[model samples]
Target: MAIEDNPSREALEFEGQTTVIHDYAAKLVPGILQTEAYAREVLGSGARPKSDEERDRLLSTRLARAGILGDFHSPVMWSLLDEAVLRRPIGGPAVMCHQLRHIAALGEQRRVRLHVLPFEVGAHSLLDGIVSLMWFEDLPPIAYVEGLRTGRAPFCS
Candidate 1:
């Protein structure tokens, strides 16, 4: 399938594909890797969902995106996270503890690889924002950068 920019969370898909996620999170955990409680906290603080029902629906969708990681034929996932991602306490200490443990568990999975970029690494190439690169057999590699507004662009391999 041809790759496309996905600004809408509901339409994002990695399913049974090879995906590489590199994120520099200064605020909260990355969306695809967030726990339910973590996601709710992150979303709640920023989006200001009109009602609890809407928030739940959005949270459910975020959780559903995680389904691909555990499917029968799961995708190859490589997540490179900044060390700062672990330092932020988005939903209090308990939530952060759970989230960190969850991330470690996910990293232990066969199809998932997690790398943490230490703060001592100093200046680096990817210092700007969160970037996700999706690879498919038939189409050229596509990349997405997250910021004030997400933009889909091609990252030349």
Candidate 2:
């Protein structure tokens, strides 16, 4: 079960209490941490700017506190983060370094997998916008494709 949030595609307004986005992230993080291969394939193995060693240490500590290590032990979970995401300095040099190091550590886990879709990969089906797919135990796969005006749901056969 992978719950991915694309800031560009999703308009997440901060309301009091737990927003749907945060709820989704919180729910999925545990599963993602358990699957080491999936974590590496998405968060790690991406290009980023330079940073210092202190930032790396901070990232490790944060990851551990966040219970990422426990998540790596799960057998059925993963998530994907674009290369552009890893490169983007959401915070600053230190923050970015910590984040990237966290990603790299998660990547090193055998059960986790991270994939970097290079900028050169160019446009694809998701170029127009963002979409998410959810797989349920007793139900068919559901996909949510959102646009500026509205969204649509398509079932996966």
State model 1's lDDT: 0.66
lDDT of 1 by residue, 1-157 (tens): 2332224252255433544444455444667778998978866775433468766766776687777777646557777888888998889999999999989988776546888888899888777777777777766666756542343445647
- lDDT of model 1 at residue 6? 27
TM-score of 1: 0.77
**Would you list the C-alpha lDDT of every candidate in the order shown?**
0.66, 0.38
Cα lDDT tens digits for candidate 2, 4-78? 322211211111111111111211222223223332222332354324453343234323433423443332224
Flag regions of model 2 displaced more than 4 Å: 1-69, 72-75, 128-130, 144-157
**What is the TM-score of each predicted model, taking all chains together?**
0.77, 0.43
Alpha-carbon deviation at 9 in model 2, angstroms:
18
Best by lDDT: 1
Q: Residue 125 in candidate 2 has what lDDT?
A: 53
